[model samples]
Structure formats: structure tokens, C-alpha cells
Target: MLVAIGACYLDTILTTPYYPGEDEKLRATNVTRRRGGNCPNTLEVLQQLTSHESTDEELPLALITILPAKSSITSQQIRSAFRSRVNLDHCIYRDGFEEPASCYIIKSKSTGSRTIVNYNDLPEMSLEEFTGIANELGPKATWVHFEGRTPEMTLQFVRYLRKQFPSIQVSVEIEKPGRPGLQELAEEADVVFYAKTWAQNLGYRTAEECLREQSTRTHEASLLCCTWGQDGACALERGTEDFKHVAAYTTENFQVVDPIGAGDTFIAGMLYALNCKRKDWDLSKRLAFANRVAGMKVSQEGFKGLDRALLSFG
Candidate 1:
């Protein structure tokens, strides 16, 4: 099973008509609340995509995340959402903090572009938490995936894990770059996945450029992947002949209801495809699958628009 570690947020997304003037007040047409946060979102998508044909077996995925002692969301809600697909034997429910972190996402009616206002009071998971979970789950986990929002904390956790067990493969999703002490973490990651926006945030023209710069500076992981919306994705493997480009799937006729978690869904699809050990499928194939998953996600109105059919392994 793949183990994903990171924070989980509850997202509040609003869809409304565009207002032309600053003085004009706009009315929201729709609103949605759903589970979010990079790692859980991606892991959830993976779970949906890799469901078994029969109900007898569980999906080959697990999530290790933090939750408050008492949640507005009921225990049944949590169980119904993830327990079937993910092995939560190492999960924790701690007694600190307010309601889970949440985001206020706004989508423009005219352009379909989105703006998000997020609120988070993330409590850093301690080393003891990491070691305890790792000791229990590391031996059985084939892959460890972390979303790079918590750089220092995640780096320390991953570094410790690698030192204790160098055999497991580790993948990192670099959501925000230019973070202090990030280069060291990059050097230790087995694979790095990034988006164009993160590259721009780091002052690079593109994600590929950022990856190239990292390769020049560090003797880190060999594989770098950059996901581009609509246009598709690109990958650079160390010592490989050249860079590989993956084209996005066509979505000309689909109606896009929401696009909030598309990128996370795309990453989940890629990870799922990789874990399936489909060596015959190239990077392009993976990206195509990812693009399809993302496009399908946007066609739905809420986060729960994700269903078993979208994640069909068949």
C-alpha cells in the first residue's frame, strides 16, 4: 500500500456570477463543502481509481493524517468516506486545534477561473508521531508520498524514515517552491511532482525550468514531473536520453461544474497508474489518464462528485 502523510482541510467553494463593478454585490449560485488538503485529496482520488472489482478486498492504499478529538464531521462520515478504500490502521485522532483547516474557493462565471481564500491552523506533527506510525506501517508500505506544504516538518520526517529504512521509495509533491531548506528535501526524495503555478511562485518561467535548475544544483532524486493544465505534462529523468512530454486529454464537450480539486485528482491518477506496475504504459499514457480524471472531476459540481465509476480500474 502507498502511505500518504499530510494535513487535511475542509473546503468551502462558492460559484457565482461575475460582477463588473467594485460597488456591485454578487450573489453566489452554488456552494460546496468537502474534504481537502493535498495529501488526502490525492490519496482519496487514488483510492477511488484503484477500487477492486469485488467487495471482498480493500484498495491498496492507506492514509496517515491528523484529526481533532471531536469533529463537526461525524465518525460515520469519516468512515463512510475513507475506511472502505484506505487502511487507516496508523491514523491518529488527537485532542488539539479548532475545526479542521478549510478553504474558501471562488469561481468566476465568465472565465471559469477560480480564486481561493484558505484558512488553516495546522499543528505540526511531532517526530514521535512519525516514528510511531513508521514503525508500524513502513515495512508493509511500498511507497511513501508527501505533499510539500510542510517542508521542514515533512523533510525531517522523511529524512528520519529514510535513515531508518532506506528500502521504501519516497515521492514528494512540491506544491510551493522557494521554501527554506527545501533543496535538501528534494535531494532526498525519490521522485518529485510539481505544477506550473509552483514554478511561477518560485520565480521560474516554467516547472521544467525549475526542475532543470534543481538537477544542476543537487544530486537528488532522478525523476522530475511537471503537470500543466490542458496542455498536459512533462518529465525529466536523470541519465535518460531526453525529456518526455505527455499530452492532455480532449474535453471539448464536457460541462465543467467545478475545477477545485482537479490537480490533486490528476496526481492521484498518475500515482495509481505507477503503482499498478504498468511498465508498458508510457508517461504520455499516464498523463492522458490523469487528464481524463481531472476533466471528469471538473464536470461535477462538488468534491463528492467523485464516485466509483471515475476511479474504475477496469
Candidate 2:
């Protein structure tokens, strides 16, 4: 099974024709509430792509997320957000926490941009608690992707997973640039995923510029990938001096229905193409597939039918 480790939150999203200016009150055209967060958004896409496959033949997708205490309404909503195809057998229930972490998003329809404000009150998962679940999932895990949060402990998790489950392809999402120790985790991971905003924050103007420079800092990253909004994505394989670039998937309609989970969808698509059931594709196909998956996500309201993006490959 493929496991994703991170925090999942209850999301409140609002849509408006345009982002309002400072101190200006704006009315929303619509509001949507659901379960979201890096890991959950990713699993929403992966579960669909791998859904209905016999577990005996395919590696199932599993989540290792922390949630509110069992009795909370937020916890119940989270539990009900996904289908039976996703394995929540290894989730962590944070006791004494009644409210789930929440995110409020304001999206601009005209520009397809979103402003996000996250509110997380629960405590971070302790190493002991993390290991308890990782140990059980280790033997069955073919690949594990970690959301880059709680940098210090996350770095430790990478080390422990490496020592305990060396055969697994460990991937780390380095979306938050200010998170200290993320570089260390990136150095240890077999795959490192970079975010465009994170790269821009570091003064790099292009995705290739960021990956090519950061490639030297990673000691063991066999694959380094980064997605830039319209420019698409670029990746580098270990021992290669040149980077491969793929253009963004363009839909004829040119519509961006939602951008809230586009990045998560990109990561999910990449994981599916690189290590899931149809993993044997060459690097070019893998990159293109992920691009199309994300393209499809932005063209829709949510993750429903996001897996159809893969149908083109067949």
C-alpha cells in the first residue's frame, strides 16, 4: 500500500468574482465546506485512480493523518469525506482535541487565484505515536509521501522510516519553504517534490532554476520535481545534468473551476504515475500524466472524476 502522512483539516471555501481590496467587504457567490489538507486532498485523487482494484494485485492507498477526538462532529465529517476505497486503519485520533484543524479560503474567479488562512489548534503528533502507526504500515508500504510540516519531527520520521523501511520509496513534499529542517528531509528522501511558490520565495524565477540548484543539496534524491503554474513542470533524475520540462495541460474551455487542491492533485498524480499500478511509464509520460491530472482537477469543482484524467493514457 501507499501511505500518506500529514494533518487533515475541515475546509471552508468561498468563491467571489474577484479578490477584494484591503479593508473592502466583498460578498461571495458561493461557499463550500469539506475535508481538506495536503494528505487528504491527495488521497482523494489517488483512491479514485486505484479504486476497485483487488488488493491482492494492486497496492492500496492508505492515510496516516491526525484528526479531532472521535466524538467531535469535525472528526465525523472527515471520516465520511472519503469512500471505502481509502484505508484509514492507521489514523491518529488526537485526544483532548475537539475541533479539527480548519482552513478558510477566498478564491478569485477572474484570476483563478486563492487566498488561504489556516487555523490549526491541535498538537503535533509525537514521535512515539507516529512510529506506532509507521511500524504497522512499514511492511506493506511500497511508497510513503510526507507533508512537510513540523520540520524537526518530520526530519526524524524520514530517518526512522529510512532505517526501518529502507526498501520503501520515501517522498517528501517541500511546499513550505520557511519550515526549518525541510532541507534535511529532502536530502534523505528518495523523491523530493518542490512547490512553485516555495521556489519563488527563495528568489528563483523559474522551476528549472530552482531544481537544478537544489539538486546539489540533496544527497539521495533520485528524482526532483517542481511545478510552475502555467509553465508546467520540470524534473531532474539523479546523475543527470539536464532537466526535463513539460508544458502545462491546456483545456479547450480554459476554465479553472477551483485551485484549492490543485497542488495536492499534482502530487497525487505524480505518486500514482511514478510508483502506483501504472508506474512503468518513462519519465516523460509520468510527468505528462501528472500535468493532465492537475489540469483536470482545476477544470472541475472537486476531486470527483479526477481519475478520469488517467483514462487518456490507456
Candidate 3:
């Protein structure tokens, strides 16, 4: 089983031919809404990839996220996005208090860049809530990924999970480095995925430098992975002095629709391949598969063909 912990969002995705400047109003080329957020995107991809598996057909997925305050419309939309296999019974629903909804304005024609405006008014999950659930389901999951947010609470969760469920492999996405608990979370996580921009924010010149720096400082992280948009990704495992770089998968033959969730998809693909536990596949092979998965994601809108692409991989 795999569990993903973090925030959930009702994303309003807008597409326009070109990005508008100040005070400019233009009709949208397309508009679609869906359940988004780092955790949800990864969970959704994992759900799809595992759906076709014959050996692990019964494998379970649990999404630990915060629910909006009794908003039926938003709540239902979020639920509808999750697969039937995902366990949502453990989520925390903030009662009476409404969190600001997340919205994304994407310019498809102008190189598929997106402007995200989000408000996280909802409270982060308390340690007590997480402990209660972990106590009940400690041995069920073999792997867990966290969307690094609410640094204190997230650190607590990771600490507890490590202390109690020592056998479980933990991976954390350090997407927001400015969060209060990131340093601790990174130090404790078995695998840390650092965003390229976040690495630059921390004064590292390149992903290799960031990984190398983090490798020297942390004892728990066996693998540190970083993604560089068109340049692809690179990773450095513990005890290694050199970085392994993999070029980005090409999408020249296909139309690039949306690249909003490509990173999450890459993480999901890598996690899925990791959980498969094939001894013959090394780090570069695994990264190649993840790159292909991300390429498939960017070629379409909203996770289309993700499952098929994953299964089709050699």
C-alpha cells in the first residue's frame, strides 16, 4: 500500500491563446475544473497505474488530505476525482471554516505557462489527528509520500512514522522550501525530491550541487532527486560523489497541452516503479521511466493516457 499526505484543491484551470497584460480582458479558449494539489495529483496517477496490475490488484492507496468546510459542491468534486481504490475515510474535514480555493490561469498558446493563485487559509493537519490514523494503519502501507507543507506538522508526522514504522519507506516532495518544517522533513526523509526553483532559492547553483550539499548534511536521505524542466532530471544517492543526469523525454511529435501537473506525474511514476521492487532496474533506468511518464503527461491535458503509458513502458 501507498499513502500520500497533504492538501487538496478544487482547481479552476483556464486556458487562453495568449497571456494577457495588465487590465486586459479576453475570452478564454477553454476552461476546466478538477481536483488538484501535489498529493492528489500523485495519488490519482498512482491509482490509475495500479488499476491495471494483475499481481497487485488488491494493493491499497490512502489519501490523507484536508477537506473543505462542508462545501458539498467542492467536496463532491474532490471525491469524484479520486479513484475507487483510494481510501478517503481518514481525511480531516475542516468544519465551519472555509479555506480559500486554488485557482490556476494557464496560457496554452504562449508556451503553456501557468499562473497559480492559491490561499491556504485552512489549518494544517494536527499531529494528534495523524497519530490516531497512523496508530491504526501503521503496518498497512509500505511506502508514503508527503507534499512538504505545514512544516511543523509534517515533520512530526515523518518523525512518528519513522520511529514507529521503521520498515516503511518515506519520500517527501520539498516543493516549498520556505515552509517552516522543510529542513527537518528533508533530513528525516528516506528520499527527498527537491524542486529546481526551490534549490536555486536555497543558493545552490545546480541540482547536482543541491543534491551533493544535502547528501553531506543528511543521514537519512538515501536518494536526492531534482527536476530541471526541459533539461530533464538528475539524482544523487547517498555515498555517491557523482550525479546521474537523464535528459528530458521528447514531445516533438505530440501537441503539448498542459504541463501543470508534470512534476507530480513524474514523482508518481518514479514511486510506482520503485514500489515494483525490481532489482535489475538501476537508478537511471527508473529515472528514464519517470521521464517517459512525465512526457506522456505534458503531451495531454490532465493525466490522460498516464496509466496506459506506464503499463506500456519496457
For TM-score, the strongest prediction is: 2
Give the Å error, residue 298, model 2: 1.1
User: Lowest summed-lDDT stretch of 10 residues in model 1?
Assistant: 305-314
What tens digits encode model 3's per-residue C-alpha lDDT throughout 184-218? 78899888888987888889887778888889777
The root-mean-square deviation over C-alpha atoms between each candidate and the true structure, in angstroms, is: 3.2, 1.6, 2.1
Order by lDDT, highest first: 2, 3, 1
| lDDT by residue (tens digit), candidate 2, 72-126 | 8888888888888788888888878998889999999899899999999888888
What's the lDDT for all of these models?
Answer: 0.71, 0.85, 0.81
From the highest TM-score down, the ranking of the candidates is 2, 3, 1
- Model 1 per-residue lDDT tens digits across residues 1-314: 78888777777777778633667778898787777778878877776666642444333788787765555453235545674667766766766554666777878887888887777665667888889888877578778988776687888888887888888888888766466666566777887787777777777776567767877654557667777766667777766625777665445686766777777887787776576635656665665576667767778764454544344523
Winner on TM-score between 2 and 3 is 2
lDDT at residue 101 of model 3 (Cα atoms): 52
User: Which residue runs of candidate 2 sit more than 4 Å off their true CA positions?
Assistant: 52-57, 240-242, 277-279
Cα lDDT for residue 284, candidate 2 = 83
List pairs with backbone clashes in candidate 3. 151-181
